[model samples]
Target: MNAHDARGSTQLLTRLFDATPSDAELQEALKAAREEYRVLRWWKLGQPAVDAIKVKLDIPQERAGSVLTELVQLHSDKLQVTVNAFPYGLPALDGVLVDVTMERQVTG
Candidate 1:
């Protein structure tokens, strides 16, 4: 199906930030607390979502995620970003199988 037909689909872009310390020694690096990563979603009205991340992280106004073309330009050493697109509809389900788990696990 076309983009317009993918009603429930969205493009997700995630940014990861890690401490400068080595992973093996991370636990001992008490001063190097890891920061939380941020994710951005793209859609017809997705600018506001991007803006929210910018505001929450105090990102510069110039680093807005309004357009995909500009997304890379806004990148910095502060974080690493990965983009993924999921467009689901008749086209995506042409031969896909659906499975459900009926078993529930018990915990103490």
Candidate 2:
């Protein structure tokens, strides 16, 4: 999907969860999903899905950003990456909302 379509899908899915999940909670969920996807696919560590799957998992903004930065540095030679987070809801400690995605470019 195009960037706009992908973003729309992320937002739609994020709504399925609680109106707001903390950054830590979102990161843990995304990390879990990515690990599952990787094991199922038997893919290498730095594949495109490594990042996109993280996004598809729906992580929070700050944690996702931190995780993506660490991943990028750790796998700099194997992956090229882009990360995005869509924040929703009011900016508050209890009601803050965010959707995060990390995109890894695939090269032949």
Candidate 3:
């Protein structure tokens, strides 16, 4: 995905992918992207579905699935994904849940 930054703050995903980013840098990007996803209502708990995290991250669709898998693995304790309860709605991804239960403690 040749995605430009929605905020125009240098394309995050594309640049990060093209370079040799440190794990910390990559984690930071993922964290930012995850927050953006939540704010956009794509990461809601009971919501029907959401655009894939890769879409929000501007990750190429070709690699989006893999990237998402990586994200789940890296944040295994904090993230989880399951099928959408209402396929009539999103029919794709609605189960991309984040453990906000501990968010305040971690980021507070």
Candidate 4:
């Protein structure tokens, strides 16, 4: 398998071997993680526009949009710092190694 595939498999295995949490424990963990990273926006190149990040914030749909927009605008700097740190976000995955090989050739 390629390095990318291997890394994905490793992560799957790691999660599988990890102990499962109770529903209450899971909810608490999710709440903490979400609070730390308020928004997670991902996109592929050439997409028409950014996809929406959805959350059931327990507010009316009408007000949720305005609230999220205001929060993002108010904390744009902090949000950006969180986004920038996404690449190195998971410390447990630090042991995962990747080796890529390149072939140099001349094409006419």
Candidate 5:
């Protein structure tokens, strides 16, 4: 995938890739992408079926887990992290991994 496709800020990065982008320019686009991610926002469903990051945020399913991890770690102040447990009740998949999600931190 092209840089823009991966970043999801296609318009901003499209021009950057056409020519060599300066350090400042690249940093600027990165900042813009981060802000967009925050602005778009994400939420959780009552059931463990589908999630906002995968369906609403339009993030690829393969990357959802890692993306959630980075978002909470880097922007903890702006986000509220939660872990929901729904036991698989099976031997093979029970010990695989945990489920984690994030939502915006509400303000008064």
Candidate 6:
């Protein structure tokens, strides 16, 4: 498989292996991640338009818009950081890796 395909496959497997959290916990995590993303975007991009945020995340513009909406609903508070996706190789599968970036918010 090509590098891109391998990475995507690896990501899918990783998602499957990660321990599943309760719905409430998952919601909380998503909320926190969204808030962190917004604060960082505002600081770095100056309250960028929705389309811009999507481009930065490498996700669809519509998804980015949805994320922005959710962020607004959850927390008006702002923080600074960037979320990036990277390629990680699969532990068991040979020549397979997935694109996944760590969700990190830069804080002083």
Name the best candidate (by lDDT): 5
TM-score of 3: 0.24
Clashing pairs in 5: none
Instruction: Give a tens-digit lDDT track for model 6, residues 1-108.
Output: 543444432333233324344668768976866654323222112222211122233333334445544434432123222333332235632221112222223346
- 5 or 6: which has the higher lDDT? 5
lDDT of 6 at 41: 26
Per-residue alpha-carbon lDDT of model 1 for 10-78, expressed as tens digits? 211221222233555546543332222122322222342321132112122232233233344444554
Error of 3 at 52 (Å): 19
Give the distance in Å from residue 90's predicted Cα in candidate 4 to where it truly belongs: 26
> Global CA lDDT of candidate 3, please?
0.36
Ranking 1 against 5 by TM-score, winner: 5
Model 5: runs farther than 4 Å from truth? 1-75, 89-93, 96-99
Worst 10 residues of 4 by lDDT: 78-87
lDDT of 2 by residue, 1-108 (tens): 543444433433333332345678878987875653322222223332223433323444445555455545633333344444344445633221232333344567
Compared with the true structure, model 6 gives a TM-score of: 0.24
Evaluated at residue 40, the lDDT of candidate 6 is: 22
Question: All candidates' TM-scores?
Answer: 0.19, 0.30, 0.24, 0.25, 0.26, 0.24
Which 10 successive residues of model 3 have the least lDDT summed?
A: 99-108
How far out, in Å, is residue 12 in model 2? 28
The runs of at least 3 residues in candidate 2 whose Cα sits more than 4 Å from the true structure, single-residue gaps closed, are 1-54, 60-65, 71-75, 93-108
What's the distance in Å from true for residue 89, model 4?
Answer: 19
lDDT of 5 at 73: 65
lDDT (10s digit) by residue, model 3, range 6-78: 3222333223243346779878987966544433233322222221232223343344455455545433333
Question: Model 3: residues >4 Å from true position, as ranges?
Answer: 1-55, 78-108
Clashing pairs in 2: none
